[model samples]
Target: MLKDSFGRVATDLRVSLTDRCNLRCSYCMPPEGLQWLPKPELLTADEIMRLVTIGVERLGITEVRYTGGEPLLRRELVEIVQRTAALTPRPQVSLTTNGIGLERLAAPLAEAGLDRVNVSLDTLDRDVFIRLAHRDRLADVLSGLEAAHRAGLAPVKVNTVLMRGVNDHEAAALLRYGMKHGYQQRFIEQMPLDAQHGWKREDMVTADEILAMLGKEFDLTPADPRERGSAPAELFLVDGGPYRVGVIGSVTRPFCGACDRVRLTADGQIRNCLFAREESDLRTALRSGASDEELAERWKAAVRGKRPGHGIDDPTFLQPSRPMSAIGG
Candidate 1:
C-alpha cells in the first residue's frame, strides 16, 4: 500500500496523458495558452501502461482516472482505458475531460472499458461558455454529455466551477439542468491552480455561498457522511432523497485529511499532492531501464512524503508551478 507518514493510503491514481488542451478557460491559462510539453517528453502508451500495471498489481491502486489539459485530445486514450480495465482485480476506470471530442469518442471509450466520465460545463449559456473557455464549443460539450449518457456511463457527472460575478448566479439553474438530464452536478470552488497565478479569494464562490444559493431554490439536506468516504465532494441529497448534488470545497473546506489520491504526470513524474512543489521523476528512470520494482519503490516514496494538507490558508503557501491542466485536474 502507498501509505504516507500521515497514515493515508493512496488507492486512487490520476494520470495525465498530455499537457495539451483544446479549450483555454480563463481560469486555467491565458488566451494564448502556456507552452505544452513536447511529444518526446510525454510517456508513450506502453510506458504509461507499464506504470499503471505496477500501480494496480504492486501498489494497490483500485481507481484510475485519466485526465489531461483535455484527455479527449490524447489519441491513444481508448487503448489506455482498455488496457487498464484488463488488469487483474481490474480498477474502476474513468476519465475527466473538457468534453470536446467526447461526442464521437464516448461510445468508443465506454466500449473500451471506461466506467464513467466527468464533463466540465460551467454555464448553460453559450455566450458565457465562449467568454470563459475562449472557444465556441458549448454545443460540442452538450452533445458529448448526451453521448456519454447514451453510452451507458451511469451517473454522468458534470463539473462546474462557479466564479464570482461570472456564472455563480446560474447555480440553481445548472443543478436543474443536471437533474433534468440525469447528470450529477458537482460545483467545485476555484483554487489557485491557474498558470497565470491570477486566483483571488474574493473572486471565488465559496461552498457556503454555493449552498446558500441552491438553498433558496431547493431544499438540500446533507447526505450520509458515511457514504462520502474519501471522495472530495461533499454530497447533498437534493429535494429530500434519491437525487443528489456535490460540492468540492477544495479551498474553503479542505478534504486533504482524507485525501487518497496520487497523480502521475504526462512526463512520468509522480505528484503526491496537487499543490506539491516537488515531484518524483519516473520518466528518466523508466527510459534508463529501471526495473518495475524500482519504479514502484520510487512511487511509494513519493506518496510517503505527502503533506497533511494543501495549506492554501498558510501565508507561505505557493501555487504549484504546473497549472490544473498540466497537473491532470
Candidate 2:
C-alpha cells in the first residue's frame, strides 16, 4: 500500500473511462456544450486496465470506481469491469453513470461484477429535467434507474446537484421518490466547481438548508459517512424506514483532508485534486516502456504531492479551466 505525505493511503481510485458525456447539466456543463478531451489524447482500454491493476496492487486501491464524462460511453466498460474484478483480493468494483445508456447496459455491467450504480438524476419533473439536463427524456433516465434496480444494482444511489433556482426546490420530492423506489438519493451542493467559468456563490444550497427541507417532510437523523471515499454527502436515515438522504458539502465545506481518491483521466494523467490545474501524465510512462515496478514508483511519487485540501475554500480561487463533463466528474 502506498502512503502519501499527508499519511493518507490510497484505498480508492476513480477511473474516468471516457471524457465524453451525453447530458449537459447547468451546474456541470452549463448551457453550452463544453470542450472535450481529444480522442487520441485519452487513454485506451488496455492502458486504463493496466493502471487499475497497478493501483490495486501498489496503491492499496481496494475499490475501483469507473467514472466518466459518462462511463457508459466507452464500449469497453463492461470488459474493463470484468478485468478489474479478476484481480486478487478482488476490489469492490462499481460505476457512476449518467443512466442514459444504463437501460441497456446495467444488467451486463452487474453480471460482469459491477457492485453499484450512482445515477445522476437532478429532477423528476420532465420540464425541469430537460432544462437541467439539456435533454427531453426524463423517462429515459427513470427507465434506466428501474432497469438498474431490476439488474441487481441494489442500493442504487441518485446524484442530484442542487442549485438554488434550479433543482434545489425539488429536494423533498426527489427524496420521496427515492424512499418509494428504494433508492439512496444524495443531494449534492451545487459546488463552485462546474464546467463553466465560475460557480455562483448565491446559486448554491447548503447541506444544512437541504437537510431542513427534507426534515420538514421526513424525520431525518444523521448517519455515518459511507466507506473510504469523499464524504461529499452527509448520510441520514429517514424515521424508521429503509431509505436515507446524503448531502455533499463540497461548497459550504470541503473534505480534501481525508480525500483518498486518485482520479485517472480516460487517457493517462493522474490528478491530485479536482481543482488542480497541474496533472502527472502516466500514459506516457506506460508507452515509454516503464515496467510495472517503475510505473508503481511513478504513481507513488505523484501521490506524495497531494495537498491537504482544495483551493475552493478561498474566495479568490478560480474554477479550473475545464468543466465537470470533461473532467470525468
Candidate 3:
C-alpha cells in the first residue's frame, strides 16, 4: 500500500468531474456564483481516465469517488463512470452528488458499475432546505433520494453539513430517519475551504454535541472500523436493526491522524488536504506536453510531500486557494 507521511495509505481518491453546479449552497458559495473553469482548462474524460489509471496502479488506490459542484452537471459523467468500471482491478466506485440530477442518472450510473452513493442533503424540512441551498427543491431532492433507493444504491447515505443555526436541529431527526430507513446519516462540521465565502470557525457544530443527542435516544456502541484510514465517523448501530450513523469532526474535532484520501480537482490539480494552501497543477503539466513517465514523476514528488496531518486542531487552519466546490467535497 502507498503510505503518506502520516502513515495513511492513499487508497481512496475523490475526483472532481466538474466545478459547475445546478444549485448554490449558501456555505459553499456567495450569492453570485464563482466563475466557472475555462473549457480549455478542464480535464477531458480521457485525461481523467489516464490519471485514474495512474492513481490505482501507483498510489494503491482501491476506492474511486466521483464528486463535483454537481457531478451530473458534466455531460461526460456517464463516460467517466463507464471507463472507471472498465479499469483492470475494478476499484470500488462511488459518487457524491447533490441529488438534483440523481433521479435521471442513478440507475444508469448503477448499471454503469457505480457501487454506492453519498447524497448531500442538508435538511429534511422544505423551507430549511431552500434556505440552505438557496433553491426551493427539497421535494425534488427527496424524490431523487427515493429514486436512488429504487436504483438499487443500497445503503444509500446522506451527507449533512451542520451549520450553527441552520440544520443542527435536524441532526437527531435525521438519525431517527436513518435508523427507520437503513440509511447511514453522516454529519460533517463546517470548515473554511476558501476565503471568498468568508467561513468562520465559530459556526462549527462539534461531534460531541451530535453524539450527546443520539446517546439520549439510542446506544451508540462503537463498531470496529473496517480498515485503516477508513473514515472519521466512528460507526455505530442506532439500537434498532443495522441502521448506521457516521460523524466527521473535521473542524472542531479534526481527524488528521488517519486521513487517507487525496483530491484531484476538475481542473486537474492534486491537493494534499482540503485546507491546502498549495497544489500541484497537473493540468499545466498535462497541457504543457509532459510525457506519461514525466507526469508520473511529478505526481511522485507531490505524494512524497504529503503532510503528517492538517493539524487543524492545533489552533490553525490553512486558507485554501480553492473552495469546497473545487475540492471535490
Q: Pick the candidate with the highest TM-score.
A: 1
Which pairs of residues collide in candidate 1? none
Error of 1 at 187 (Å): 0.3
Residue 106, model 1: Cα distance from true site in angstroms:
0.8
For residues 1-329, write the lDDT of model 2, one tens digit per residue: 66779888778888888777788877777666767778888888888888999888766899888998899889898999999999987999988987998999999999999999999999999999888888887898899999999999887999987777777788899988988898988888776556666677776788778888888878987665554255566677789645667778876767777777788877788887778777788899899999999989988888888877788767777777756665666
The TM-scores of all predictions, comma-separated, are 0.99, 0.95, 0.93
- Which candidate achieves the best lDDT against the true structure? 1
Q: RMSD, each candidate, Å?
A: 0.6, 1.8, 1.9
lDDT of each: 0.95, 0.82, 0.80
The full ranking of all candidates by lDDT, starting with the best, is: 1, 2, 3
Instruction: Please estimate how well model 2 matches the true structure, expressed as its whole-model Cα lDDT.
Output: 0.82
The residue ranges of model 2 lying beyond 4 angstroms of the native Cα positions read 224-230
Tens-digit lDDT string for candidate 1 (1-329): 99999999999999999999999999899999999998999999999999999999999999999999898888999999999999998999999998899999999999999999999999999999999999999999999999999999877999999988889989999999999999999999998999999999988999999999999999999999999999999999998979999999999999998999999999999998888999999999999999999999999998999999999999999999999889997
Which parts of model 3 are misplaced by more than 4 Å?
Answer: 194-197, 225-229, 314-316
Q: Give the winner by TM-score: 1 or 3.
A: 1
